[model samples]
Target: MSNIESLLPHLGEDDRANFMKAVGSIGAAFAARTTIEADPQVIAALPQVRDHVLSGGGVELDMSAALDALKEEPSISNQLIAAEVKVAEVSKIQSDTANMSRIEKMNYARERGLDRPRDDVASTMTMNEHAAVLAGLSPVQRMNYARRHGLV
Candidate 1:
């Protein structure tokens, strides 16, 4: 069994599902946000520094001022920052997924003769069908129909 699957036995069902969702969300976010950079330690790492800037989110900082901050705190770790950013992104994704999953589960339960709402509009009519209905009417009738529906 996978690590997450093994952990499921230890958790309540709701918590297990939540944790799985959180993990999946985090993995997805990390995958999305990752960017590769050249390793600094390797020789022939041209230009002597990784002065690469992130592409436009419209950050407005003077390079000199930014450099001074870096000089003061040279131990800054992108991995930590990225991890925190990813956690927030992942949480949002998990919440959205959970909500959608709940809806889908409810829909499935309904399909299985469970708590389904009545009065569902099951019409599969296309736009062409709707247009045909309009076309079938006399011009005056169509105009009146459109006027009544505020479509005119």
Candidate 2:
């Protein structure tokens, strides 16, 4: 606040009020975005969400808190932009292409394996299949099963 205040007189012909308003708005949005991202579940869900962000589609999120934030510190743009970035994270049906550069979009496309089927069950035995089959076992039970199958 002091920094902005010091600059206000030097802004000269610039609208000081508008400058303050813009600064406050940016602050609010960053705060709100930080709040939403603190949850481990949200972080865990991101890979899927990035798909939506990559595609230029909207994700429905509750923005009432963000709206109320403008009354205090930051602007709505950061909140919205942050949300769009989040949106691209989870939904396989979408991606946040609007916010991405062409190079980034192309990189995403390349890394996403456009040719691979989304559901690819292996025709051969895989470690992932072992994990799924073993998921319900207690440690002792898993050991017993492994020994029984000559897999220990």
Candidate 3:
């Protein structure tokens, strides 16, 4: 079982269900708040519980202290937000590239110097031809293309 699964048995039924729902919304970085040493399952689950509290996961517990605790760690929250932004940017780039037309793909390759002898013919190239051209680019060239399109 995952660490989170193992820790679930320690919570009350309602608390456990709420915690599971809250975990889906919590950022991955919350796990960093935990210590390396083994502890009681309930103690091990505190970071997630704290996240649930901060998120107002329909629990009756007062959140003032949890809010205050989060206020004290602004940097961690900022880092999490920044990481989320990067993930979003990458996802957008992937979706955009995956749906790009042949002309669009060739234009991207040409802009990154991955295409040779750029000409009007590129604009009329078939999808198979575009794929072959893009596939033939060097690793560095491919990386450059991705970076230019904000995939990296």
Candidate 4:
């Protein structure tokens, strides 16, 4: 409400259609960013996207400036501002996890067969860290690993 009031002065009186397009653009941009960032594999590749959005510029979903470029009525402008807030809220929801205790989190994971044993050393590796560990092993060590894991 207040955001719309603040930005209304920048819009032209006849820009209702452009305001709608800007709002839609802002929403589509946000949804696209969210989709890209959701994938752990792609996340590492998009440093520009990660640095810009994940680090800071995400909430800068700039519909304010978008609307400011267009001309719109006060009523439509208000609705557009409200839509921008809705876009920002999706990112907020992603950052927040349900307030669960560690035990509860473990239980939740266990229920879904996703919990790792607390003492499992390999569970903590990043990406191909295990491959590096395996590469470092001696022939004797490799044979032992295969025997211990019942792979031989």
* Candidate that would win on lDDT: 3
Q: What clash pairs does model 1 have? A: none
> CA shift at 100, candidate 4, in angstroms?
31
Full ranking by lDDT: 3, 2, 4, 1
Which residue ranges in model 1 land beyond 4 Å of their true spot?
Answer: 1-6, 35-152
Q: Clash pairs of candidate 3?
A: none
lDDT of each: 0.43, 0.46, 0.52, 0.45
Residues 6-100 of candidate 4: C-alpha lDDT, one tens digit per residue? 34356555343333334456445534533311222222222232222332343444444433323143543565676678778755543442677
Candidate with more favorable, higher lDDT: 2 or 3: 3
Error of 3 at 73 (Å): 1.4
Off by over 4 Å in 3: 1-29, 32-72, 101-103, 109-152
Ranking by TM-score: 3, 4, 1, 2
On a 0 to 100 scale, what is the lDDT of residue 101 in model 4?
Answer: 74
> Taking the tens digit of each residue's C-alpha lDDT, what string does model 2 give over 32-129?
65553232222212322222222222443223443343323334346556677766665642445567887987677668754232334423546677
TM-score of 1: 0.20
Candidate 3: deviation at residue 9, Å?
A: 32
Tell me, what's the RMSD of every candidate?
A: 22.9, 18.6, 13.5, 16.7
Q: Write the per-residue lDDT of candidate 3 for residues 25-94, one digit (tens) a residue.
A: 2322234442112223333344545555434465443334433344346564565566778689777667
User: Candidate 3's error at 113, in angstroms?
Assistant: 11
Top candidate on TM-score is 3
TM-score of each candidate structure, all chains considered together: 0.20, 0.20, 0.28, 0.21
Error (Å) of candidate 1 at residue 25 is: 0.8
Error of 4 at 78 (Å): 25
